[model samples]
Target chain A: MATTEVVVSILVSTLIGGIIIGYLSQRSRMCFVGGVRDYVLVKDTHLLKAPLAFLIGAVVVFAIASLVASMPTWPWFITKSLMPIPGAPLAANAAVPIYNHIILAIIGGLGIGIFAVFAGGCPLRQHVMASEGDKSSMLYLLGFYIAAVVFMAFILPNIQIF
Target chain B: MTEQKERKRIIKHSYLIIIAGLVTGLIAALLQITAGVGPPNAPVAYGICIACHGRDLINWIVNAIGGTNLGYGTLVAGVPVLTVVGIVAGAFISSTKNKEFKFRTTKNPGVSFVCGFAVMASALILGACPLRAVLRVAYGDAIAVVGFIAISVGVVISAAVIKVNARRAINREVT
Candidate 1:
């Protein structure tokens, strides 16, 4: 396939995937926190099933695609490279040293987890919720965008501890 | 007798939920592994991250500042925009079909906004959100595991807060 064709195909597939996933999530009323909370609060399990199903589906698709197409099977799509400082140790590949920085990783994870709970959803869940016409989720998404811009521009540069 | 039976059913359901969650995590991991390798003859991974593309945008910006190339920014931001737009469009269609479309908001807008900001900021700081984080781990990024553990700790803490608040609300109602 030509480069343009390849790009177009990928875009189309991604869109289809996102749409299908989003629709399914909405129909299922799947919220990650809600699922876990249901289990914790009252032992309800309906909401949790969708995410589990999603994960399974994703894995299966990935496996098939990897084997058939000779693609890398790891989740490189989701990995973001950390900007290494001058003194920071570099991994063999472009993998960020931050992956090895246990302390910062833990702190960052704690923040994400707590914030997700407070927001009543993770970032992905917020997207799903927004798609469902949840106004609160839209607000959350706005906040998320702002935060993303801010972190990338300002906060990330000063943190030497990580 | 009815209450006891209900409790037993609930317990059974909870087990199912746990199993489902574990399975989902594993599946997501598997997908991450497959997608990590770029598709045959393609420089880009088939399903590269929606958010990491944002980071790539930042990289482009930095490169631009350094008088380097800027062509890559479009690709970085483009995929996420398409994915999110697709998500919204899909939801709309589904809601239309199900007759579940409605504009709704919580009682407290301010709190919701704050929560949203917090969630996004935290996600940005970690370089990926929960979904991305898990995918990162699946792809063999050891750092993502730390982020996931931290996410669990955060969840527990927040859950405790919810519990306390619920208790207080119950006490107030009782009085």
Candidate 2:
């Protein structure tokens, strides 16, 4: 297949997937942290089930796609190697370190967890909510976009400790 | 007698939750298998995430501002836009059918804004969020796995803080 055809097919598939996800999320209220929160706070396990469902769904679909369609499963670079994009500063000369850095990992994790709570959703939740026509979610997404720009331009440069 | 029916309802709800969880996991695993390790081929990341794409966007922006010639992150960024557009359109259709489309707000707008900033910033720094992070980890991305663990810890800690705050608010109300 031509490159453009592949790209188009991918886009179409993604759109279909996104649409299905949006519909499911809207109907199911599938928020990852929210599910946990609901279960913890009220003992209501309804929300908690969505993430589990999503995971299971993704795994099954991925397995089938891999077996029949020759779909790529698990990119090797993300795991075993870090391809230093020619001049990128963040690109490491060595393999990206994998494990045993508990402190930094914990700190980063805590930061994400707290922020998700405050944001009233995780990244996945934001997408789902945005799909459901939440104007505030749109605003949150705008923040996300701006932050991405800022991180690349300013913050990343200053933060030597990654 | 009525309590028995209520108990049954709760059990059914629990069953639904379990089923959904299984399905979601299966789909996620499938996506991982299909996308492989290199850049995703279709829908450009196979419903992966905005964070990874956003990281590429940042890389492009950095290269542009620094006047260094680099590959544009358009493919990564553009896919999310398409997916999100599809999502909004889907939701619109669903909401219209269900008659649930209404503008609403919470009492704490400032908090929400801060939360949004923090979430985006953290996700950007880590190079992915929970969904993408988990997917990456499943695919054998070590950094992503670390990031996922970090996010989980973050969530648990934040939940604790929220609990405390809620308690304080309750006490204030009582007084």
Candidate 3:
């Protein structure tokens, strides 16, 4: 297929996949951070099982996928440089130092963890809860959207570890 | 009786989580294979992420209507990923269908909003949300592992604090 066709196909696939995921998540009440929190605080394995299964399922599928296609960048740490996968600032480039990425990951992960606990769920959970007509989650998403713009404009530039 | 119990266990919520996780992996792999990643749609494990994909979707719309070039992942350069949109739609449909949909208001909208803002800022800094972090770890990224560990630590810390506060409240009531 042509590039445009491929993009469209991927978009449709993602939408469908997302629908499946969202439906399942709603039914299951699957929240990764919640799982970790529950297990840590109460030793409740009930919620914890889902995220572990998620990790295992993804790993097994990813391993199989590598055999079917030429995943040159599949195992990114070994194939590419030690820098984390490109989802952050300078995502497409390798200009940022390795340590910067590490530091960013630490700070980012901690912030997400702490705030998400207070917010009552992770991002995915918040989105689902908002859809369920939770007014608080809707407000949460409002801030989430606004912060995306603010991060790109204000926070991203200053945090560049030059 | 045992057969019925077995049937119920098979249809448990955890099973749905497992299916969702496997399907998520399959979607990511299929996108990579068919779309031919790198340029215009980079980032491995780009299938399903709440934070990154959500940001990309917003950026795509803003850039389209406002004609402003806000930077975003190359994957959504042409069209935004609709995973988050689909999530909301799907969740809404499922909740209503299951009669689980209810309008629940919060006492602390401002606090929730601030927490949301902070969560997004940190997630972007890390460059992935929890779901994406798991994907990266599965894809063999070492840094994501560190991030995951730090996230666990943070969760533990907060959970402990919350537990302590709850206990204190109980103690005060007893007094």
Candidate 4:
């Protein structure tokens, strides 16, 4: 297929996939931050189980599909490979860029995690909620997209922080 | 006999839903990461990344408006935006069909908006959505671990604060 054709095909596939996910997520009330929050605060495994199920499902499918795609070799199983720890023999040439990964990934992840809860849900949850006419979610997406645009136009250009 | 029969049916129905969810999740993840698809119109800072999807998409729009990227990079005309749009559309359709669609307003829109800004900023910084971080890790992206651990820690810390506040509220009421 041509590049455009492939792009079209992928977009359609992604759309349908998104629809399916949207429906399933809606039906299941899939909210990631809420799941973790419930698990931690209330000892409720109920909501937490949904994300776990999705994670397991996605991981299995992704791992298999990665075989079909030309890609980088994965550097982890369940954790950062212990063998690649700084000062370890493999650390010197390890695929993991320790400094960048530590700074961006950790800080970014913490931001997403904490703010998602504060926002009441992650993007997936918020978008769907927005569609359901949740005013807060609608307001949230406004900020979400604007921040994204600003980041690309201004923040990224000035700072080489990935 | 009727109670037992109902219980069994509920369990069976739930298992079916789970299987269906798994199938759809797999298909969606597969399609999103298809190698058949070419690169975005502009130089993408990242690929197959959900957090950056919105950013790339907005950049595409900006480039389109200006008719050129002004040398920042080749700005693409599009990204995986349709998928994000599709998600909302599908959920709306499903919810409407299921009679679960409702208009709910939060008492605190300002708070939600600020939190939303933070969430977007963090996701952009991390370069992937926390939700889809699972797929990245599954692909053996070791860098995802730092984000994952940080996210979990964030959740735990917030949960602790929430519990403390709840206890404080209870004490005030009792006193």
Candidate 5:
């Protein structure tokens, strides 16, 4: 297909996929951080099951897809290095070392975990909540979208600290 | 509809999540197979992510309308992924249909904003949100596994902190 067609198809497929996931997410109040927090605090498996299910489902589907298609990086751990999949920073500059990627991942993980917990839901959950007319979640998304621009433009450039 | 039929129609949350996951995986893979969205341009597991896709979508719009060359994933250089938009629309439809949509307001707007800002910053650092982190791990990215462990550790700590705070509040009330 042509470029415009490819873009349109991607947009359509992703929109449909997102809508389905979002509908289910709103019904279930699915939150990954909430899942981990609930299980950690109370040993509750109700929400935890969603992330587990998602992992298993994605893994199984991806495995099936790999059989038919030639994905050079299907199993990234085997084909690529053990480094985390390159984020914007690493993606921009491939020369960043593996250890740096690990460090970044740890820092990022901790921050995401702590803040998401404090904010009351994961990003997806927040989005669902916002859609359900939660003002706080809407504010959260406002900050989220702004920060995305700030991070890409300013913060991402200065984060060379190893 | 009969109560029994309605009950049978209500799918379990686990099944819903599983279906979401499977569809997400299929979309990612199909994008690769049909549209060639991988490797050189897009990374593996580039299907669905709250943070990355939101960033790419917003920037794509900004660059298009404002004539600003804001950076975004090359995978979405042409057209922004509409997943985030769809999520909002879908959730709105679901909540409104179920009569669950309520205009709940918060006292501390700043707190929510800061939390969102920090979350996005960290997500960009980690390169994936929790959902995409799981996707990366599923695709066999070892470092993503480490990130996943760290996220779990953070959650444990947060849970402990919240527990302690709750206990403190209870103790204060008793006193």
Candidate 6:
């Protein structure tokens, strides 16, 4: 396939997948923040099932698919060690040092977990909220992209810690 | 009221909802793996991230509308996350279909944006969102376990804080 053809295929396939997932997400209101909150507050496991199932399903399917297909698979986690190799792309073939993983996990995870609650939803929930015309969610999304861009360009380079 | 009732029924049927969620998640993952739409299955699993993918979408929009690119590789890299766009659009369609599309306004926009900032920053730091964090664990990235633990701790702590604040508010009202 031509370069343009490859890009188009990737985008189209991804969009279709997103549409399928988002439609179901909207139908079910499957959200991690609400799920965790409910589980903590009321001992309810109902909402938690969505994320758990996604994890389980993704693990099983991806493992089996990769094995069966005999295609090369990247490491299970973010590969930071291979990145900054002088010519590697940011999105593809990037890696981080193993020592840094610990800090990133604890602090990063806690922050995302906490703020997702304050934001009133998970990432999936944010998309649904914006789609439903929630002004606050839209603002949150705006902040999301802006911060994402700035972080990737500026903050990510300077951070020696997690 | 009817729409609300219907939503309640759907939630109440936990088994059906779980099955549907599982199917959709599996299909999404399968398609992403096949399509090779992303770097790998780590911090970004295809186009699933809100913050990262959202940036991609926003940059495309901004550039299309006459913003100048500085010619840096990242600045000029044109990977528009149409999946994220499709996500919101699909959600809009579903919300409208079920009559659940409520236009929610916020009393505090500053805090709202702050929450977004916090989420994106932390997600970048962590190298993944909560969803991908769990998957990272399954993928055998042992480091993510600590992150997952922290996520649970954060949730439980927030719940306690919220409860305490609510009780305080109630006491003030009663007084």
Give the number of the best model, judged by TM-score.
3
Each model's total of backbone clashes: 12, 53, 0, 2, 0, 7
Best of the two (1, 3) by TM-score: 3
> Which DockQ value does candidate 6 get?
0.51
| Clash-forming residue pairs, model 6 | A79-A95, A79-A96, A80-A95, A80-A96, A81-A95, A81-A96, A83-A95
TM-score of every candidate: 0.70, 0.74, 0.91, 0.80, 0.91, 0.82
Scoring only the A-chain of each prediction against the true A-chain gives TM-scores of 0.69, 0.70, 0.90, 0.78, 0.92, 0.79
* Candidate 3 segments whose C-alpha is farther than 4 A from its true place: A90-93, B1-11, B35-40
Q: Order the candidates by TM-score, highest first — what do you get? A: 3, 5, 6, 4, 2, 1
Q: Of 1 and 5, which scores higher on lDDT? A: 5
- Compared with the true structure, the alpha-carbon lDDT of candidate 5 equals 0.80
lDDT of 5 by residue, B1-175 (tens): 6987766655554566656555555554555456545555577776767898899888887778888776676454366778899999999999999999999989999999999999998988888899888888888889888888888888888888999999999999999
- Per-model chain B TM-scores are 0.61, 0.65, 0.86, 0.75, 0.83, 0.75
In candidate 2, which residue ranges exceed 4 Å CA deviation? A61-96, A99-105, A157-162, B1-46, B53-81, B140-145
lDDT for each residue of candidate 2 in B109-149, tens digit (9 for 90 to 100):
66666667777666654545666665554444555556666
> A43-161 in candidate 3: lDDT tens per residue?
87766666666677667766776787566777777787587877776344567667877887899999999999989989999999998999999999999999988888676677555
Tell me which residue pairs clash in candidate 4. B42-B74, B42-B76
Chain A alone, model 1, TM-score? 0.69
Q: What is the interface RMSD of each candidate, in Å?
A: 5.8, 4.8, 1.9, 5.3, 2.0, 3.9
Judge the docking of candidate 6 as incorrect, acceptable, medium or high.
Answer: medium
Error of 5 at B82 (Å): 1.0
Write candidate 3's Cα lDDT for B8-85 as tens digits. 986675577666656656655555556544434667776667898888888777778888777676554367777898
Q: Show where candidate 4 strays beyond 4 Å.
A: A62-97, B1-17, B32-50, B66-81
Cα lDDT for residue B167, candidate 4:
96
lDDT of each: 0.55, 0.56, 0.79, 0.63, 0.80, 0.68
